[model samples]
Target: MGAQVFRAFRNFNLENRAEREISKMKPSPAPRHPSTHSLLGEQLRHHPEIKGEIASKNDKLLALLKDVYVDSKDPVTPVQVKDAETRQEPKEFRLPVGHHFDMMDIKNIPKGKISIVEALTLLNNHKLYPETWTAKKIAQEYHLELNDVNSLLKYFVTFEVKIFPPEDKKAIQSK
Candidate 1:
């Protein structure tokens, strides 16, 4: 019984509040687009001479276009283009053949950097004769930074594998 009375009072209050809000709001005016003729008239009134000047320029442009159509007596030549591959210089003249680096092989090589062949040769030389191929000597010969050569000698090395027979070769396996 109490719930029904509360619901009825809430509905009545909501209806009255909605009616008051509706009465306070004013009706907004509808949007209306101006006709094309009226818009044209307004533009003409603001700039009376623009239309005549535009018409004259348009006639001049048309006359220039007509002149282009009338002047085509010269022969049109097709351009001969050489192949892209033939025109461009090769990036690498010679591919590396072996693990050795020859002085003649590096004629076209850029400065301050060694090729893979050169790097391997340096590493092999360092491993075989450390006194001869010291970091300073390698850096001077290869045109590389001393610090970089030091780091390369410190971090990189050529692997050497050594295998030994089992302690008891007669026995097939050891437990």
Candidate 2:
């Protein structure tokens, strides 16, 4: 009878240990996402569709902002603002504007594999205009980020869409 009780007690201890081990193996719940008022959302790699939608929305917002804040064509330069006393006002400021690039003014690139930015520069240098060539088209063909494409386009316009880039005056030149 004593042996039987000892066996039963041993069984009970083993069952309790198994339960404890199972509890330990269970995973903890993921942390809850914080509200926008608390902090910006963390960037995640999953959900490609959602990311694409967000990127497109950002592009539209950027385009709208550019339209409202900047004019590429025929920008107005700021001159000295005269007060009633014929004194210049400190309020005089020029709006930052990019030069308008004529698409056709850009050169055509030869059929070859090259980085999109390099291809653009080459086309600008040769002044070979293609019927459907554009930064967006090039970006799509190369599977590149739209933001990168737009930035290069902005730089192209800033350089007056010329074949030669503006010399970097700040770079150290070896005498």
Candidate 3:
């Protein structure tokens, strides 16, 4: 194949060409607009009472705004924090003092569900003694579905450790 010589900037006088073309063209005359009547001015001229009412209302609004306006130089006071003793106790329903509740047992919990405390206990048991606290046994003991127990045991962990990337590429620079 023969090599082709293509020059992109062979005649790169774009600004000069644009200026020459612009100079050759005559400027168009300014647009002539028809004079239109102002309806608002006509209404105000017809009703002088309305104009007075509008002016009075505008003055009243300005006076009110002036009263509301706070000067920039004025010092702002910090909000006062309420004392613990002075604060009112929240009014919420509480279990009666005589009511008995077990942390590990699922007596009142919904079917196939366990509370956080119970879950932790079961997980701890499984971790400590995997043979004793298998998914089947845990499910039977907790009154949960075998599949749910398996999933919980498979995915859930007591806690996870995440090592975040350093803010700087070199966390520490050696002198």
Deviation in Å, model 3, residue 130 alpha carbon: 0.1
lDDT of 1 by residue, 58-91 (tens): 7787888878855556664443333533576555
Which pairs, if any, clash in model 1? none
| C-alpha lDDT of all candidate models, in order | 0.76, 0.53, 0.70
In angstroms, the error of model 2 at 39 is: 59
Indicate the TM-score of model 2. 0.20
Encode model 2's per-residue lDDT on 14-125: one tens digit a residue.
9789988987866879766667524433344444576667666576778888878554776444443333437654543222122234443334433223434554553463
Specify the highest-TM-score model's number: 1
Candidate 1's displacement at residue 123, Å, is: 0.6
lDDT of 3 by residue, 5-71 (tens): 2343645787898889988968898754533246666777899899788666577878888889565
TM-score list, all predictions: 0.38, 0.20, 0.32
Model 3, position 14, has a per-residue lDDT of 76
Cα misplacement distance, residue 28 of candidate 3 (Å): 38
